[model samples]
Target: MPKEIKNHICEEETFTGIYSKYSKSLHDFLYYKFGEYLDPNDKMQEAFIKLWENCKKVPPSSARAFLFKVAGNMMLNDIKHRKVVLRYIQTKPKEYTNESPEFIMEEAQFFDKYQKALSKLPEEQRITFLLSKADKKPHKEIAEMLGVTRRVVDSRVYNASLKLKAELEEFNKFYAKKPSKLL
Candidate 1:
């Protein structure tokens, strides 16, 4: 009778043996050839995973070469991806802004607090303030639009300003000290 041939790594024992035999060498090969930055350990594990996935298609004798080839190809693909990323970064458009990150953050906080404070104002005061400042309507125009006297419109705007300024006193002090620091 002829000796039984082991033609594939489909069996768990055969696959595990192949992994035990090749994993370390494959990892070392990748590390030596590509350096540690490319993550040889990860590549080795992924190569093993690929081998397991294709175990029935591979023979135990060829498993070492298969793992090395798969891991090397993975490293090459990673290098290619890095090159594409570098190229994209080189070609990316740059937009310059006069404002610093701190300035932008502070501005956003100021707006948030301003909106909250604005919303908390009396309805008449809020409406008058919005019409005068947001709409750029004068006190006379606001009075006409709201059917109120000019004095009432002025009073509402003045009261609203006082409330908003009082609520935002911290921002005012911060803003007062920012110009010199920014320059």
Candidate 2:
């Protein structure tokens, strides 16, 4: 009976006994090696689950090494995955807008107001205006795109531009001369 107890960790009593003896130390080992962010508790519990599933094959004498090795390998895999993601991000070029923070903030604010004013525009007017300004299409091309006469496209775009200029602060000053400022 004593030799069987020494040889097998599959028995319920021996498994629970080993769990109590080693669970805390195993948790501490993982915690110290990987910080709380990586979830040491999860790794520890996973290691124990693997141990439980293989209890019949593993002896009590080798349990500690088995648990630590499994947990360490899992942690290493997670770290390697993080490194791959970081490498991907590093390979991407950063957007290099030379504008100052204040300029960028003011531009955002203007964009918000412009979006609001544009949304308030009548649908046909908004569509025509966008085709003209955003697509840089001429009035004749915008008319062709909208399946409307050139005069209709011209009126819609003109009315939409007037409403935008009125609703947006500093828009006329900045936009009138090729947008030298507030781009």
Compared with the true structure, what per-residue lDDT tens digits does model 2 show for residues 26-102? 88988888878788888988998999999978878889899999998988898999999989988968778777999
Quote each prediction's TM-score: 0.49, 0.46
Error of 1 at 75 (Å): 0.2
The sequence of per-residue lDDT tens digits that candidate 1 reaches over residues 1-183 is: 121145457777778888888888999999999999999999999999999899867767778889999999999999999999999989956688888999779877877777799899999999998888777789998999999999999999999889988888764665465533321
Task: Report the poorest 10 consecutive residues by lDDT, candidate 2.
Answer: 174-183
lDDT of 2 at 154: 86
Off by over 4 Å in 1: 1-7, 94-183
Residue 27, model 1: lDDT of 90
Compute the lDDT for candidate 1.
0.84
